[model samples]
Target: MFIEYLTNLLGTVYKVPGTIDPEKSFLELEVDSLSLAELGAQLADDLGIEVAEEDLSSTTTVAELAGLLESRGADIPA
Candidate 1:
């Protein structure tokens, strides 16, 4: 499910690069900051939530972002 979100966020076919856990840095996967922001907005839209602009800078992992969305009451897609 998470991987699907990432793929949609990046608009590409993203495979887990290694055994890297979701909590690890997206930098480890080489996702750039601009892409990450786009990901955040896409996530917000998909989940029907508003992700603040400031939060985008520090959301550095898939799990972290997911947690933020969850906290905002997003029904994370399974």
Candidate 2:
């Protein structure tokens, strides 16, 4: 669920094209630090999950980010 949300957010909010592979690192996806920080802000606003930009940056892949959100109790829809 989080994967889907992250993918949609990346594509819609960040203007990322094509399918986002969960296993791929953000560096591989060409997502810059500024974009990751924006994405963290979006997650806080939209999902009520307070994620630090550094925490998001530390995550290596989309899947890891999803796991972090889940660990933080984000209500990701199935």
Writing each residue's lDDT as its tens digit, candidate 1 over 12-77 gives 534444555666667766766776677667767677787776665543676766677767777765
Q: Which portions of model 1 miss their true places by more than 4 Å?
A: 1-20
Full-model lDDT for every candidate? 0.62, 0.84
Candidate 2 per-residue lDDT, tens place, 1-78, comes to 889989888889888789999998888888988898888887887888898766777347999999999888899644
User: Per-prediction TM-score, please?
Assistant: 0.63, 0.87
- Global local distance difference test of model 2: 0.84
Summed backbone clashes in each candidate are 0, 0
| Model 1 error, position 17 (Å) | 3.6
